[model samples]
Target: MSTPTGFMQYQRELPADRDPIERIKDWNEFHKHLSDEQLRTQGARCMDCGTPYCHTGMELAGSASGCPVNNLIPEWNNLIYRGLWREALDRLHKTNNFPEFTGRVCPAPCEGSCTVGLIGDPVTIKTIEHAIIERGFEEGWVVAQPPKVRTGKKVAVVGSGPAGLAAAAQLNKAGHKVTVYERADRLGGLLTYGIPTMKLEKNVVDRRVNLMREEGIEFVTNTEIGKDISRDELLKEFDAVIMCGGATKAREVEIEGRELNGIHLAMDYLNGTIKSYLDSNLEDGNYISAKDKDVIVIGGGDTGTDCVATALRHGCKSVTQFGTVGKAPLERDIINNPWPQFPNVYTLDYAQEEAKALYGEDPRAFSVLTKKFVGDANGNLKELHTVQIERTVDPETGRRIYKDIPGTEKVWPADLVFIAVGFEGPEKTLIDSFGLEQDRRTNVKAAYGKYKTNVDKVFAAGDMRRGQSLVVWAINEGREAAREVDKYLMGSSMLP
Candidate 1:
């Protein structure tokens, strides 16, 4: 620890974000940075726990219990606390290939499992992490370091999302010639398109990609495997292949009036908006407009929250989100949700905070189920029919069920609807072309930590194999898959 009583001396604090209402007016990033002194104080809060669970990176109760990247949190925390910034950045980069991405987007599981959190608030690990990386960039310490020698082995990574990028970076570092294939015009598959611009600016992603390009990795855009490029061509060109294609197939909600004109998938809506915003600053009348519309976003996840924020930015009259489950408790239920499991407590995320600022209330309706969408004579969505629901358990099968409450049905006005109910699995196009086996959930059949598929010299990782997951988990899978690929290519591997 920086100091024995640092945790007790300094209470947890975070830099204030831009006012939500003011920030929604523009698409630029709204987060502000803390000064070096404040960040150092925050770093000092790391406790000297002999057994640090912050970086254990274990899964518990179907959620991540700690940092999935297994970041050396305490080490960097101590380094930053003692005013050793370059050293802190080095310690951070030793594990996470892209701290800039994770620091901005990751819902930090490291904070939940912090030993200090058991007593009081956890150290601002994420903030400190963000600070360290930004400092590295400002001081010009983050630069491309090309491999000293080439292994003469060539590897191909499909998709350019978190997993694909991490895998490509690692494989290149191991002296292998790496080529990444992205179907989209731009790189960073989900990172470039799925996430909104305000949350993760495109410049940050481009900065990293540009650096990677300088390190001798080849990136091919607008080229897809199995379609634009044949399966035989890939097998003939590379010694091994790693599928990092993310789970892009968005899940649909089957209900009445499904063919309404205004009903759209969340990813499509988000993807178009971002593309248009980047292309022509929304001047080109190419994307869907939410102006003067009453929007009802279906499904209450991060995507739904983002829909709400996007609508508000478009000058929508009103926006509301529907959730199938009941509201989470204000605090964790100690008996059910113990420490180390990501705390199931209630907190306002960035997008929700923006929604609440404009609407004067939380925009989410919990335990509400949409029965059908109502449309006009022109087949345009106008409203949605819904009913209140109650939770119950079946004694015989021990299965949880949702029971609708009587006399609680209502109609909500909705000029536009976005289905943000998550994803099923990776797209089957490339998977089928390779003739790879799939799990019952439609994910590529690859054992965790091993990443080897049934097909020879072909492996899978990230959302392609793990289904829909966090970016940090995708990074973990990508890094691990690179190690496995290295071992398979050579007699043994030294990759971590």
Candidate 2:
């Protein structure tokens, strides 16, 4: 029997965010948290669907759908509804180590598959997650709990990104001495540098890293394996090594003026800015500044969106986002992209919203592909030569193919260009040093459950193993890698 409300009984409501125009001026998080009362009502909106595909972690229609971490959504919602926040946090943390990061940045596939969303708006799962974890921190409930015993086994973890962090946390919890080596000067790879501060504050990352440190996870920064330390050295010092060095090598657009000086990879630009901010607050010359320049971002993924937002924060003259694929329709169930899954619909993200407020229209061009970069004599980029295109599915193979529409070429003004197409795979330095076999996509070759490399003691996880992926996927890989490591060390592991 139903405990409270049935279908269509509850109206959907979520917490409000800060003003778009006001938020773009600074890099602070724009989301405003809901009052405890407001949060409870939002939690009560979950109708407790029978199937509950929200947390099932399923793959539907050839794409990964639902939560990869398989979080206990309904349980936490009910707990939060009863004002049992501590219990709610515990339930939330049971599957996810860092809900705070996911809450802020995750695409919220859980909401996409929400049963309530089939007819009405989905529950505010992401906002509720943010509220629960923040409450945990505020009440002093989120404390450092070092393991009771150390397993005498030493593990070396490469790459200090989310996957590495999650693996270290779980492996350390299993009583193993875990040392995380980050090439960057600080911990939390992408979380610390790749993402812009407007979306996720560095303070949030620091707070969690500090807790992990107190919990006995040793963090070694500014150390690059194969350069600073050899693969053989890691083998001798640690019983096992886990490589979570994300897919950093971005996929480049091979055009006529690809080597132009002002054009740069999204990660390089974002990381430089983040590192500069961390060092001396804009005085540091390490990052690329998009201040007072016409910026063109290639690719319309999250990374491209971030570039637009960051450029706006840096006082860019103008910003435009280019997407090769056709523009998504405003509504779902349009036959182009269906529902009961991740609906491929056009909705303005935070960055797009800010751009529209400043420019009076969404600065996005669909079905447009860059043909060449027009650069001045000094090898500096000045503009982009692009053409509109159309994509059609092959009748025989059913695969979508893109073709440029002739006579639709145009030149767009640009002082800086950020390539956000995507990533190919991990770097080749460590892979060659370790002599690790790679897949067709150039990702580290390893079975799904068997994160082991060709080398006996070496392992891989996250983007390196699975290719460019989400933060949630990295966390899952880390947890799974830790479980495998525990089993390797003690002959069997109780860790889930």
Candidate 3:
């Protein structure tokens, strides 16, 4: 249970980040690491609550309240506090297939729901998680344990993102001949190209992919399903197919000047930069440069934050982010978003912090809506027409609606505009070709946990199944789908 009184003795602490000005000069990860001793103290801060809501994995107020992967949080915290590093890694791997990925990019919902957070602060769960997995890698504890007996059954996993990777790893562990097909040239889907190197380094992803390869899982890249290879060929070649193709259908802003030259989707911009950076350190000029331009990013979310950071790194002259809703409260409101639920509080993300440091002001403009893009004679976007909005809750339905404030119209100069509004669902070509049913959101129709599609021997999980979601949720869905696939193939299975 960790040290019983440890929570009282030590306060929560996190690894100090590098100065934003210096860190933004390059596209490398900015956060520094905590030493082993400090990490142990942070782990010791776990309160060992009777409920242990940190690992509950339940829905509260329409959002996940705890670790979506149902990570054995308390067990690992106790292990780390007890100085059993390897044991903590084992416990971490029991539920989550890729702690390194989650440790780096995940928002750490578990910390938000921590019992310690009820009053003072939450244990540094995410940092401790990062330390544990990195320690395992450093000590040569993490290795390939190929299955001894092959089931002789073959499985094909579509996509190479978190969900697809998780399913492939679990299925391979169950002795099924597994082949992961990624549409992208790289094995790690969004992890490889969609996210910037500063947030999640490509080598970190490659390290795990290489380990998976060593464990006998075959990976085929630049292979698009239903295009390069027909869906029928996949069904015919494999005993089972798990579709983890993420929700790549981006939600676009359909405005008058959307066709302007400087406007681009968030994924395209991010992926292009990474691709160019990787190929020749940006000498290829394949990416849309934000240099010396007034950048305006629409949609204030993680993707938007990433865009802001990327633009800053490209030496953008200025940057601004538009938030459709009003700014969140400075602190969690007990009357509304109570404890144990994911807090709806205003927090400065890395990108926002960097922007504030660079520009001497927060880049975000809340309660604002972009009406249309104004373009120059050359059809290049020049300005964004926007208006302030006030949120009003309907008395009958209790639904929140936005009302435009008259005479509050304004325009912002913008040389480059990025749409980071979010995703709708998976692309239609693959799902349509398979003749699979989809939910109203256009996500593949697969019941949670069951993961079975209407078509026999086919399953769906992750963003493809549940629209846009967190990486941790994708890992959970993928692991659960793998178990269901194993059961379908072998009648009964040992996968957890």
List TM-score per model, in order: 0.99, 0.97, 0.98
Model 1 regions lying over 4 Å from their true place: none
* Candidate 3, 68-172: lDDT as tens digits: 988889889889878999999999999899999999999888988999898878899999999999999999999998999899999999999999999999999
- Per model, state how many residue pairs clash: 0, 1, 0
Give the winner by TM-score.
1
The 0-to-1 C-alpha lDDT of every candidate, in the order given, reads 0.92, 0.89, 0.93
Clashing pairs in 1: none
> At residue 311, what lDDT does model 1 achieve?
88
> How much is the lDDT of residue 452 in candidate 1?
96
lDDT of 1 by residue, 408-460 (tens): 99999989999999999989899889998999999999999999999888999
Ranking by lDDT: 3, 1, 2
Per-residue error for 348 in candidate 3, Å, reads 1.0
lDDT of 3 at 402: 89
